[model samples]
Target: MSQQPPAQQQSHPGETGQMQPRPRDEMADYTGRDLLADKKALVSGGDSGIGRAVCAAFAKEGADVAIGYLSEDSDAEHTAELVRRQNRRSLQIRGDVADEQHCHDMVDKTVREFGRIDVLVVHAATQEPVSDFTELSTEQLRRTYEVNVFGAFWTVRAAAPHLAPDASIVITGSVNGLRGNKTLIDYATSKAAVHNLTYSLAQHYMQDGIRVNCVAPGPVWTPLIPSTLGEEKVEGFGEQAPMGRAADPDEIAPSYVFFASNRLSSYYTGEVLAPTGGEIQAG
Candidate 1:
């Protein structure tokens, strides 16, 4: 567990280097058991934070990772380097997830690099807090849904044909979706839709021997927090959780590894795993 982050903020789409008490997003001490040996994966939002950690962990597990990002060229390059250091191939595909065409392009590019995609991690998302529900703008609402909801739908739809049997699709959901948030109204709603999407897609893809699951994390120490939340909220970030601290990217990544590895989670489908720092909630 990590201590609470200091009061800090960054411009949108924050960078890892600019963060104080730099996040443990590299999975440096983790050792892979080849659970994903030779598998090919495409991760949206693979540039920083949980996405970066997932890419690193996937590499260690012997998967060639294709990273998809918006801009953050430097961070994406660094993540690709981490995957390459594992002696696995890494491809960086940069674009905005909010665009339907870009979502399809991400899959096409990944398939081109790796021949086929065995795992698809839908992780790109954006959120902005609003002081009052009435103050939420239509633009923010649309942006939130476009990236978090529509992007997930479009990317998975495009990758469906390329995915082979026994493929795994993991979606990133949020604790806010399970229990709504006051400030993050639209973001929470978008995530709720994503959670439902997981269930629907799981059923839709089961006939093809594919598995779909979700990881709805609680407050985690990632670039998203400092970039979107106010400084006052950042200071005590995860204090509300029973753990009294935010999780490092390293901590939350094993959940993805578990879901991705057929050896571990073959029977699991349409499941939601909440790594919420001991914050218990009913289904």
Candidate 2:
């Protein structure tokens, strides 16, 4: 993929088909080695972007997947088709992850379809940029936390009972969570909470033989960029990174794959694999 310039989308939660230059989110060229053979997985926000890539990768790795999305029926259907093409069962569930009941229902539905969950990828997130801290409203902050932080909590809690031994849970974090972004105060804060949640859950679940980890990515060219950052910011979206370009979802999905496959990451737990395009940060 080539470098992308500033692009704008009129809607929040932008459609993948409308993205210019298109995000490399389908993982079309990725080949799997059956690392997750016969596993059952659940991916939140699996309709597009990182979630879509992860679902495809998991399917290619031989895991049947259940995808949870807010709406985006077309995207969801398309993703399901992609999984089916890989010869894996794909279940699509639609609802707001911020709703605790919806989270429980999603887990129940997945269990009903797949019998058990061997991997859980909590990848659904929402963000709205604020130029200054003062411009961030109470409602906006609440919504951000609800979707980015609380949603992960609800889904994990609801799925905990049904998770098989050695199950892997991967949460999506952000570079902004590690280093504050001036324009994304609320979103950064919410993701920071998710980062800590991953650590805490790792410790709490270790006794159950479940491993929890996080992938904190730098700027990635996903729908969230144009829909949230608007035209000016989107043009130079990832120039600040050492790579000078936002990562494709294709570039990030492998981290989830590594974490999901116990064969690959059995000894890893409570770790945040930061794929920030060489933007170094202090621990």
Candidate 3:
């Protein structure tokens, strides 16, 4: 147990610096192949959780990453330092992903820093508690859409113009998109939109050689769980999943790698990789 209660500090992506047990960002045994060598990529919410893992992985793979996060400056700076230690550059920016101006500026700043964009990982999301549909407030629905739907829209729209033909996009969805969790009606519906968004963008952009896809992860061990539910509920998170264990962030980052790498997944697009630990049935 941590000395401090899990501080409910409002934070942005990649901000695991303040968590009791800092999120296991890079796996001890993992090695890299320079797959993303010389590439410049962007990761939203890259200060912590799955986004933080992605940033570390990108660094190991020889890419300088731009981390776009919310308000967690300390966490974002820590993530940047870790990336720099891996001999790759890290640009940490703090802003709301829901802002269209910030969305455009994120891409602009990345291009200014790195000259061009090679990959865009849309991973930041907004979620709220909802028990019943009748109880859903219009503000809640709109805010959810702004963060989940419009956020992806603006990031991609901003980055699209500068990307090379072989650019890749990996949007983050949720397993709830697969099985509608009633309590997450708004959040789940937003994820569903991302699922469809990936396909639409993949089809429309295939001719341009830019692949768009999504990864839907099950109940992984992340702050989102503990922050939403108290510390007690966090323990049994993955008991229901077939694997009977919550995914570590590293376990989830590989899907992004598979999607981002041209050597491994060049022929793939409009795809959904469910890292849900056998929760999805075999086709």
Predicted model with the maximum TM-score: 1
Give the root-mean-square deviation of each candidate in angstroms: 0.7, 0.9, 3.0
lDDT of 3 by residue, 1-283 (tens): 1122343433323235445555566644568898888999999878777888888888888899999988877767877887898899889888988899999999999999999988899998877666568898999899889989999999999999999889999999999887777877999999999999999999999999999999999977666665565445555566678887677788899889889999889999999999898886343
Distance from true position, residue 214, model 1, in Å? 0.4
Candidate 3 deviant stretches above 4 angstroms: 1-22, 230-232
**Ten-residue region with minimum lDDT total, candidate 1:** 1-10
| TM-scores, each model vs. reference | 0.99, 0.98, 0.92
Per-residue CA lDDT of candidate 2, range 1-283, in tens? 4766555664888788888768899899999999999999999999998899999999999999999999889989999999999999999999999899999999999999999999999999999988778999999999999999999999999999999998999999999999988989998888899999999999999999999999999988887777787688887778888988889999999999999999999999999999999999899
Stretches of candidate 2 off by over 4 Å are: none
Candidate 2 residue 204 C-alpha distance from true site, Å: 0.6
> How many steric overlaps are in each model, in order?
0, 2, 6
Sort the candidates on TM-score, descending order.
Answer: 1, 2, 3
lDDT of 1 by residue, 109-206 (tens): 99999999999999999999999999999999999999999999999999999997999999999999999999999999999999999999999988
Clashing pairs in 3: 13-45, 13-47, 14-46, 14-47, 14-48, 15-47
Position 8, candidate 1: lDDT: 97
Which window of 10 residues has the lowest lDDT sum in candidate 2? 1-10
Q: On TM-score, who's better, 1 or 2?
A: 1
lDDT of 1 at 119: 92
